[model samples]
Target: MAEPQPYESALDAIPGAHPYPRSSRYHDAEVGIHTQPDGTAVRYVKRRLLPPLGEADEDIATHTVSSGERPDHLGQRCFGDPAAWWRIADANPVLDPRELTAEPGEEIALPDGFPGGGGRFGR
Candidate 1:
C-alpha cells in the first residue's frame, strides 16, 4: 500500500515533509569533475535548481486549501501522482510553497482534464 501524503505536503504533520535535498530536481545537470594534486579527478554531482514550468493555455480546476497542504498532495489527488505537485506550482507560480497555500482557506489552481498538466506543456 502507498503511504498517504498530505494535500499540503509542506504541512508540519507529515514526517520529513521537505524533500531530501530538494528531491531529484538536480538530476538533469551534468556532474562536475575536479582535478586533484595526485593526478586523480574527483567527480561531484550537485543538485541543480530548475526553471519553473510556465503556465499555458490549459484546462484547470481550483482546489481550496485548508491548511497543511503541499503541491505533491494536490498532484496526487488530482493527477494520481505526488511528483506532479510541480504542476500546481506552475499553474499558480508562487515563489514559495508557503505563499502558494499559506492560508487555511486559500485557493490554488489544480490542473485536471488531461495528462501531464493538461497536455502539450510549452516551454
Candidate 2:
C-alpha cells in the first residue's frame, strides 16, 4: 500500500478551523485562499484530479445498474456506507455520479477494499 499523503489545509492556521471531513470527496484536496482587491479573503478548494482506474489495483469489481439505483444506494449495498459513493465515483469515469445509474443495465466498475464487498447492488 502506498503511504497516505499528508493533508495540509489552508484553514489550518485558523484556530478551531478544520478541513473537510474524511467522508467528503474533497477531504484530501487542498484549499486555497485568494485575496480580492477589496481585501477580502475567499477560500476555495483546489481542483481535484481523479485517480486512474488502475489505482484500484487488481481487485476491481463490476456492478450492473438496476432501475432506480443511485450511487449512494450502490455504495450502501457494496460498502455498507452511503457516503462511500465517492469511492465508486473514483473507480468510474462519470463526472456526475447520478449518471452512473441513469440507464438501467449499465455496468460500472467498482474499486475493491471497501466494507460489505462489491457483490450485491440491493437487488
Candidate 3:
C-alpha cells in the first residue's frame, strides 16, 4: 500500500479549506467557519459516525433558514407540499404555526416527512 500523506494542518484535511473569519461569530476551534461577502456566515461542524457520549447514537440535524421563507415553503421544498406545514412546526418546537416566522441565518431541524406522499400515496 502507498504511504499516507501527512496533513500540513488540521484545515488541510477539510474538503473546502478556507481561512477562519476574524469576527469569530461561529468559530468552534474543532470546526471552521467561512464568511461570505454578503455578511452571511457558514459553519463547518464535524461529528463522528459513532456515538460520542453514550452507547446510543444521536441524530443531529442542521438547517439554514433564509429570509422571507415560512414553514410551509420549507415543507414544500423538502416534502413537495405547501400545506404540510406541520412538518416544519414539529421540527421547530419553539415555533408557533399560527405565527410562523424564521430568521435569516437561523438553523432549524427539517422534518422527516411533510407532504407524506410519493410511493405510498400513488398506490
In order, candidate lDDTs are 0.56, 0.72, 0.48
Colliding residue pairs in candidate 1: 7-70, 8-69, 8-70, 9-69, 9-70
The better-scoring model by lDDT among 1 and 3 is 1
Top-lDDT candidate index: 2
Span of ten consecutive residues with least summed lDDT in model 2: 114-123
Top-scoring candidate (TM-score): 2
Give the deviation of candidate 3 from the true structure as CA RMSD.
Answer: 17.8
Across 6-86, the per-residue lDDT of candidate 2 in tens digits comes to 543345545546566554677668899999999999999999877666665667777788898888888888767898888
TM-score between model 1 and native: 0.46
For model 1, what is the alpha-carbon lDDT of residue 105? 88
| Model 3 lDDT tens row, 38-99 | 98898766541211222211232446777787876765775566665554555454637744
In order of lDDT, best first, we have 2, 1, 3
Instruction: List the candidate 2 regions with Cα displacement exceeding 4 Å.
Output: 1-16, 55-57, 113-123
Clashing pairs in 2: none
Model 2, residue 100: distance off in Å is 1.1
Clashes of each: 5, 0, 0
Lowest summed lDDT across 10 adjacent residues in model 3 is found at 114-123
Prediction RMSDs, each to the true structure: 10.3, 6.0, 17.8
